[model samples]
Target chain A: MQPNKITGIGLLTAAGVGCEENYCNFTARNSGICKVTRFELPTAKVKTDFAGLIKSLPNEALPPELLQMLNSDDLAQDYVKAAVYVTAEAIKDAGAAEKISSDPRRTGLIVASSLGNFLNVSELVKDYFMKELYKITSLIHGMNSYLPSRLGSMFGVAGPCYFVSSSCTSALNAILQADTLIKSGIVDRMLVCAVDVCLETGTFHLWNKIRVLSHRNESPQTACRPYCKTRDGIVVSEAAGCFVIERADAVGARGHATIRGIGMANGASDFLKPSPELLEAAIREALALAQTPSDKIDFIAGSASGSPHCDHMESEAICRIFGARAREIPLFPYKSFLGSTFGTQALSEGAFAIKTMNDNLVPEPLNIFERDERVAANAYYKAADYSSYHINNTLFVNYGFAGNHMAVVLEKC
Target chain B: MSKPKITREELIEKIVAAIKKVSGISIAPEKYGDNLFALGLDSIKAIQVVNMLEDELDLMIDDAHLPKFTSINAIAAHFDSLNK
Candidate 1:
């Protein structure tokens, strides 16, 4: 079977809403990192409270029909609201809403999340002791699959609907699943949405406890300085990236990008530390599957989220895979502008890759004042305008917790 | 200690509310005696109703009694027997 194509995309991030808004902000080099205003974290407990939080999208961010469907109650739940908004936008963008609604059984949905409704789980725990105040709302919120299942119901998708959670690589893995489903003829079209809302009190506290988050509260703008010598750690953020993926030959299809290759591997090493060996293997596997030479990869959407150890590991993997060409490829550190969005960041990067390819412009990585000599020092990090270069294929790499490495090759369709 | 007594009308009202709360399907007054399946309550929705009722009333409904929970009236009778 021919490779599947991403026909439509919906994006909601701290930077902006929808595809056009986000691409414009990204090309303008605007950073979405900002002060945490959603929840008041006690200053004494952590070094910084800065995060990329979309408390709620403005009414103008959504179409009038979508706006009417969403009420204040729905908007209050961050993940639920984000999932619905992005899915609707994606379906509308693909013009698949009516098609799917008419033939519900042909469409499926897969949602990915690293942490699903931490606030609801916290409430459920509390309500466990006080049964009188208990509500079944937690059931809807706490289940990661609930996001896709609800979207399936709302959008009239009667086919396979589920969730994938593999630490931070959840989104890419979910996308991979969509690719498989299409190739195997299980579903003609799949709606994939990856969302993570870590701004909630409980989830934020746990992330801080892990000490992998940046503590540069003083400079929130530069908090996520990926691959910089002075970089502290990742700045946790929230985002949702939804896509309408279908077979390339489908009727009325306008593919934004074709997924050429998808490679996934488990390092089976440390639970927290990433393994460079396995990551390099995953990249090579993707390149082989794509049937493209390493030199043909025009650019790489790097997943360096500023963690000292992980950045070094990712750099090592890049150097190993690309060898001498590693220093020449234009590698854009997406997390620098978007922050570490966990499971959703990869899908968000995929969106950026498609947009940049369409525009034929490579934006510079943000906040990398001093490149770390220890991590991919020779790697290229320069802006490329249309006159200087042309992008045909982009590589998106993501290394998740518990040693999960995922890579995908997206070619311009 | 004795279980607090609940009237049949009150039980039916709570059941109706629980059904609406879990499934978002309002139960008409005349449908109180109708089978929950006929009223559009699936197994999952029925269990959710049971869970909500259990929490609200602080009652430990038996597993065997689940089949009897087909209608609002049947659930009220089971709860009444437990209370007695």
Candidate 2:
């Protein structure tokens, strides 16, 4: 099978918007997290009222149908608009937007969103019980596949259109699906976009009730202390990261970054908390599929989302695989820079890694500080100026609830 | 191609206004027979039209009857028949 490559990318995160802008903000180490001011919550006792809230939605930059949804009062409507905007941007970046999705029969659309417009669904349920009102559109909009289906209609992608909700690993799993399709000769092109805006009152209210969210809401700036021993909890962010992946031969000389190998495995023993052994196996699986050695990998994208439970286990996993060399290979953890964008953070990390590798610069990460001793030894030394390294392959690993794990190896083309 | 009947003229007017309010499209009365789908009305926008009609006419439309709201003339005739 021909190798698959990321020809185009479109991103809307707390980091920034669009391909160039998102990459620029990443390299500049700009923090996208801020105080939540869009809507007020009366459920008052929460520690921090701040988050990586995206206030600037480019409605004018989107297509008409998507723009209509974005302007609506329902928070869930933004899902459709965000997906379209990023997907369009990715297609444009690949230099395919002018004649994008032209072959409906050859392209597939898949989005990974867990809540699937939870705010609107909550509002609809409330409307039904309180006011005895039932709307047909509400019934359809409540489905998880509804948002991606809108994208399927908008882009005329006649191939399979679906949604994947595997907790934090959702987006990476979606990418794995696209890779499978391309390698198995199912489709030539795939448009994969992951969008989640659950920061809506209903969802975040529940998260606050559970107290898993960072209590650092007061200071959105340092709320997310990623990969550090002082880390407390994760900060939830709203974003949509998109990419148009195509067979490398199709793009030929125009290739952006090659997707070398992808690996996904379930927990062997533990049901919830992470297993360092399982994570190590996942990384080894990816390297095996990519036909690359551990020593050959230049850097590793650590999946430290301010969750110490994840950090310790993942650190052990790295040590198990790389041994003494684990301390030498630079590790770039994600959450410190953009909070935790749930499953879609996988795509954002992929985008950031691609840009940094292309520019041959490892820009300092925001909110990323002194790492716990285990990761400190292997940490990518944060520098003010771009430092040169023999970077070729980068590994991206993301863990989900229920011990689901995914590791993707991205190689510079 | 035939002209709309004089009796259904008022219902047609309200239906046109309702479509405009729901979908933001201002169509001339001559396009009364045109397909709503052809006029850029999606399932969501079409459902929005149903909602506005229910509020304006003070009648609850059956879920099964929603498909009849295809064009200005169709909606007017459907409401007229329901009024019988």
Candidate 3:
């Protein structure tokens, strides 16, 4: 069966609060990663303090009632509120708020998370163990645990409301699920949201154990170098992204952005290791579903997260998929600007690609002085020049910890 | 000269407010016993209502009891029994 198309997309990230701001930042090739100012962390491990943190959620941003409910010490509920806020904005952008609001049964919601309320969990556990206080209320637990449902309730959407947790591939998985639900005639419209917040003390230790985190305290901006030979490690960031998707017929009637195609695959490799085969399959499948030939793909939003092995594997996958043509395709590493926030990266970059297609430009990969020579030799890879070209089609790739790989293709409407 | 105890009618009102507060649902008291799942109350929303009950009424309901608290009347009765 044919899939449902995404008619509208909205995003809130460390770059800026809304699509317009993010688009401008992208066009200007600006990076939102800077010093981590919201929370306190150890001075040593925070060497590269850069993170794409959303800094401007005004108190009056959400409905008064919703804001009150969120401020009630319910961190999980705050995530729901964050998802709802962005989802509502996307729906509004799609011009479907009235239609869905009047008949919510016709709408569905899918939220994805790599670590659901991990920050809140860490704090609660710490308080329990350290202070010997069981003051963590059930409300907090329920909100943290039921973010998807809370978001559904807020929007009055009675359709499928569940969380997709696949480490980093959660966003793409959520989008794929929304597409399937719409195709099955289960719902006419769906809201896809991806969110993850930064870790607290325990999370810091967990990353320290993984040894993928940068410990360079001097310069944070220079810390996360995705394709650079001098790259050390990746920095974990926090963000949330949402999109409003509808059937092609529905979107056509309303004249909204069109979702050309989406594809997903599993690595079937070890949870921590990379898989070239799965990545290639995912890209090939996404291109096939999009009905886009590899040559037509103008740019690629690389998921090169500065992990040396992952970067090499991803580069190899691209070479395998596009063959000789891969070297000519310009590449944009979004995570360089927005620190890798597992599930949010794919959707966030997807949103960025849509904006790039809309603006007729592609943002350059920042901080990479030299291209991956092998990739550059085989693929049409370059720091993109937005002024000289108009990007019609683009591919966005995302890889998760459990060998889950997803690639999505979007075209200009 | 007050009434000996609270009536079912009074209990239903409180239950309705709590449900609305927790699950963001608006329903008439008479429709409380209706299948919440059929009414679009999924598992996550069920947990939200249970948490609200614990907060508002100081009652602890097991996660297992969620399937049984499908309606306003049912949750109210359960809370009433617990208060006893």
Chain B alone, TM-score of each model? 0.89, 0.80, 0.74
TM-score of each: 0.79, 0.78, 0.76
- DockQ, per-model, please? 0.01, 0.01, 0.01
Q: Flag regions of model 1 displaced more than 4 Å.
A: A58-75, A127-132, A251-253, A377-380, A384-387, B1-84
Question: What residue runs in model 2 are displaced by over 4 Å at the alpha carbon?
Answer: A56-58, A64-76, A97-102, A268-272, A368-371, A384-386, B1-84
Model 1 Cα lDDT, one tens digit per residue, A1-413: 68899988999888887777888888676657788877777665555688988657665656676567665645667777788778888888888878797878889999988886766677778777777566676666787766777778778899899999888899898999999998999889999999887576667766765556777888887888888888877888889989999988894447788899988888654466677888888898888888878889988888888877778888888888888878877777788888888889667878887888877788766788886888763334656443578889998898867778989999988
TM-scores of the candidates, chain A only: 0.94, 0.92, 0.90
Better of 2 and 3 by lDDT: 2
User: Highest lDDT among the candidates is held by which one?
Assistant: 1
Indicate the DockQ of the complex predicted as candidate 3. 0.01
Candidate 1's DockQ: 0.01
Interface RMSD of each: 18.9, 18.8, 15.8
In order of TM-score, best first, we have 1, 2, 3
lDDT of 2 by residue, A268-382 (tens): 3433356676777788899899888888887788887776668778878888888888877777776777777876877877787777666666656556556577564366465
Ranking by lDDT: 1, 2, 3
Per-residue C-alpha lDDT of model 1 across residues B1-84, encoded as one tens digit per residue: 776888878888898888888878898888788998887776556767876776677776644456678799898888777666
lDDT of 2: 0.74
